[model samples]
Target: MTSVDLHLEEQSMVVEEDEFREGEVPKRKNKKKRSHADLGEDAEKRGICYLSRIPPHMNPSHIRQILSRFGDIHRIYLVPEDPNIQVHREQASGFRGKEFSEGWVEFSKRSVAKRVANLLNGEQIGGKKRSSFYYDIWNIKYLRKFKWDDLTSEIANKNRIREQKLNMEISAAKRERDFYLSKVEQSRALNFMQERRKKKQKTVGAESDGTEEPKVIRQFPQNRPVADGGAQTKTKLSKDILAGVFGGGS
Candidate 1:
């Protein structure tokens, strides 16, 4: 809802008669009636002009006040670049969306519209002295043969398609990334299991190896007490005694 002004292009002018007819009072001036074909031709003569880099704060009223001085304007449509975007309702920035990149100004007459286009193109809106819109800044370009609806529709479609393409690409990249990460995790788990199996096998082989020898136990005979001459002779429990008994002990 840009600040809108329903300014009519055609204003009624009443011309009074200077001389009076004898015995006749002055009557209201008769207006000429236009045919249906003539009205159609007039509609056709309404040309559209495009403005770029329009200041966000410049509304329909401001523009009409400035450009109507140039010609009679049927209507002016301020086209926002991003239609889906909405300025906060709580704020006053709706009409001042700097995001609006361009707009369309419709003049009631083709010749005047063309005249404005030629005169204003390349010149800054506020550059010249004594201009009504002294602080306004933008450029004017006449779209020779394009209608507003067609151009706006084409741009909107393109933007929508481009956004969809970008979304698809992002989604694809995420999927690919997730897939690669899963593969890496699986590989790590597999490697860990393989290492554990190899360690267990190494331990079993070490235990089964015959590098260590079996332990041996040695026993000695007990000594018996002897009565000096004839009772019993005492046997010694020593390395020497064992060697005499068994020939040699190792």
Candidate 2:
């Protein structure tokens, strides 16, 4: 083939690639814009309903089956019964199944949600007599100006608070247990010291009683006085001697 013809074919291929890219760009942009518009419309039409009391053994799937007859359901969230209460009921009745206390259902259209709430509110759940929830009543209400994001945010905030409280309780329990253990240790140490001191005293008393003897104190007698006549004769003898020595008392 000629070089000029080959060059022309290369140019044509480049132009075609550019045109393809240009076409793809606008298609992608249009898709993004359409998605955004659809999302806005969906948000405006979305509605939420509240169920005050959920019948026992009624799960989200069961609720969807029943409510789907009226309109399309977007989402279902049923708050489970308290674990403590469920345990008590299970023991008393010997029936074990997942139970919900309350629930919230999201519908694709606001009008359908409102209609379902009105129709089902205060109405008996009529079904086969053998159905567990046949006699249960619906306590549904349409929530105005409420959104799914609001429910999710509220649930997240509650979970955060519950986690904080559980952490605080665990810390408090640990502190109390540590304090109790410390007190027990102190009491044990004090008792040990007292026992050692008592033993030391007993040992010292035994040594003193065995090695030492009792001390004795001495006593003396008293002297008596002479008679009066013996005292006078002695004085007369002393006076005669003194007269002989001095040759006379003129």
Candidate 3:
């Protein structure tokens, strides 16, 4: 082919390649756009409800099964009773099971959460006559504008504070133990030195020509009695009379 025709063919091939690339770009963009729209739909508004008091021995699974009757439950969190209280109760009653103090439930929709809280609050949990929780009452409330993240943050903060307090108590106990041990060591050292001094004194006494040295007894001075003023005056008068007679004779 001539040079002009060859150059024209090359330009047409380049144009076709560019058109193909533009078509693929729009397809990828469409896919990304659709993915974003699907995400927006999945992130529906969720709501949380608070249970001030959970029935005794009710676990998270039990709570979900009961509350799920009203709406779709997304999540459930039940706070177990304090370990110390649980241990005491178990020992007294001979009943061993997990008990929950409080709880939070998240529903798929806000309206469902609100309706469940309204209907169940202060109502009796009616079930089979033989069921344990049949007579238990509900103490639930719908928490407005509350989020699961907020609850998680609050729990984390409490745990942090508790750990810090425990660390402080342990360190204080260790310090007290160390101080007591040091004092005991000091007393032992003092006793050891006193015993050594006694032994040394005995050894020195024994080495003195096989005869024990005489120990100097310590004597406290006795207080003298004071004479009355009349006695002192009589003695002075007698002494003056004797001196006058002797001087007159001389």
Candidate 4:
């Protein structure tokens, strides 16, 4: 399951010291509260965030210690469960493939995370390339506005706020256009159907009155084909029918 942190926002600090007596713990101090700017600053300074293409056997503490030389570590955690846990566990001998080992160290400030990241990102470490560990595939990004969560909720909220107004405008225009076009289409279709029905009614009425329409005979131009002797033949017209119809050729 993907874990996400939400409820991050720019909030004003309220001084509520009067609610508690002198002996009682302050409510503000008791609650674990941190600001976006504070987290961002901490991540920048102390975060030596990295993803390693190594085995779980490789301890995270050793890597953490190495990173401590660069800056103070607020907290370090290894992604305990693998996303491909099921597939890998199914194979024999633990699949013998690389696992994702990520490391994060919260520096004292943003400058430190930046400085260390810039210096050691492409630099060598532990006799091999520093990239041999988790530094390479780290989904490391400097969160500019840490007050907002790096999650779908935050993204969805921003998207909804932005697109809600725009989408409504588009939807309204689309509905109006569809209604207008549909009316025009319906009118045209109705007119065509009505015209066809009228023509059919007329034809039926005429047929019922026994007034048969005259049939016109058409004459087609016929070209004579070549005879077996290899000579083209001329057309032999019906003289009697032609004379009766046209009153022409002697």
Candidate 5:
């Protein structure tokens, strides 16, 4: 096919003289370039292809060997149906291993893909169709308007954005919870300290009230008269002082 037929856009191409008005300068026209991937996607939109119940041993080489007889294959992809699944060897010696998967095969011609599906769907891979042992068959279906990478990437991006938002919300909630818990702890500590101080004050007040005694005021004579060698006259004894000393009645 010619380069024009391939529809490969140039990043910048000079405009033809006819594209411009007469006597005008031929200006460059910048065009959105198409990559090989874009071309492949555009071509893939024309075909139909899908395979089911693909065995683990089935690879691209196997598909080429099997389907190339039918037509030219544009692309072949055999992917695991579940990543967590393990294809284990059989416990019995010499027994084979098998794992199930799905696949897609695009053909260069749309008609070839449709014909292949019609001929191969429900066909046994291991034996003649006349035998009962040929029960292990493959299922094939035609896919329409399916772009593998675009759909998968779109889904992955959406999941990534959703996970990020959820993580952010969880982090914010945790911070809020921690903040309130700290406030509650501080309030509890403050209340405990206040109660302790009040109890101490009450204990101190009770002890002081119970142990206190009243003070007594007493009168004493600063000057004293001598008795015998420094004897004092009997009339000199103070009447109020004598009453107190002898427990005399008033």
Candidate 6:
């Protein structure tokens, strides 16, 4: 092979290796771009369902170590301690209450959560004697479909239907109350009319009695002087007049 001698100058400018000439095509860089579906799938795979009645002493690492046997675990959250709730602070120190020991767990797939739930359903986690974390296997459940809107919508619809039924009952009660009130008013009015009619009839009867013909007064004949001498005097009405007054000699 023929060799060419190259001269090097100290502190002098030299063409750099990998330098491109003018108008030369640049090398293409391969950058991978993720699709929307891929991103969605990634989010779904690592989806978390809030777990309750979890043993507080059971940390995320301990839980992951146990659950990793079933499937890949993306993350474990001991439901962020809430300053508002005193129980969380207490549980962090080892004491647990009867209420929920809530936390979230993200797995490699939705099936992983289901699988973990199935496997850990009746399994024990913590305590001096180590009792089951979940009260029931079925109770170790998930928020369906990872959409809070669906849950809220269902709750809202239930409330609305309940309100509607309550409104109907109230309306029916109001109608019944109004009907009774109307009936009472009608009874009062009828009684008042009857009283007025009775009063008018009494007044009319009094007036009719006052307008009736007056009774006639009759004068008795003077006793005869001869009759007075016999120690008693008697007054006598004529026979015809007596007959006419006493039903014509019945």
lDDT of each: 0.66, 0.80, 0.76, 0.52, 0.63, 0.57
lDDT of prediction 5: 0.63
Colliding residue pairs in candidate 6: 53-101
Instruction: Flag clash pairs in model 5.
Output: 49-143, 226-230
Q: What are the per-residue Cα lDDT tens digits for candidate 4 across 1-250?
A: 2222221111011111221332434434336789999766654443334434334444444444455576654444343445467366647456554344543444555665666666665454453454345333223433333322233365467557868988999999999999999999999999999999999999999897868877789999999876796644656678898888898757
Candidate 5 lands at a TM-score of 0.40
Question: What order do candidates take by lDDT, descending?
Answer: 2, 3, 1, 5, 6, 4
Among the numbered candidates, top TM-score falls to: 2
Compose the digit string of candidate 5's lDDT tens values, residues 1-250.
3332122112012112222433545535458898999877668644647887675455454565567688866556554444235423444343354344766776777788788888888887653456433556768887665654543465467558968998999999999999999999999999999999999999999978958777789998787656685544455878888899999956
Query: How does model 2 fare in lDDT?
Result: 0.80
TM-scores, in order shown? 0.45, 0.68, 0.62, 0.32, 0.40, 0.35
Which of candidates 1 and 4 reaches a greater lDDT? 1
Index of the highest-lDDT prediction: 2
List clash counts for every candidate, in order.
Answer: 0, 0, 0, 11, 2, 1
Q: What TM-score would you give candidate 2 relative to the actual structure?
A: 0.68
Model 3: residue 198 alpha-carbon error in angstroms: 4.8
Candidates 2 and 3 compared by lDDT, better number: 2
Order the candidates by TM-score, highest first — what do you get?
2, 3, 1, 5, 6, 4
Candidate 6 has its poorest 10 consecutive residues by lDDT at 2-11
Instruction: Decide which is better by TM-score, 2 or 6.
Output: 2
Candidate 1, superposed: residue stretches over 4 Å from native: 1-43, 55-65, 71-97, 127-137, 187-250
The Cα error of candidate 1 at residue 235, in Å, is 37
lDDT of 4 at 53: 34
Model 3, 1-250: lDDT tens per residue? Answer: 5443344346434434544655623112234446766644533577899999987766665676578789877667666688998999899998898787887888988899999999999999886667788899989999998876677777767778978999999999999999999999999999999999999998888788657668889999988766676566663547668879788434
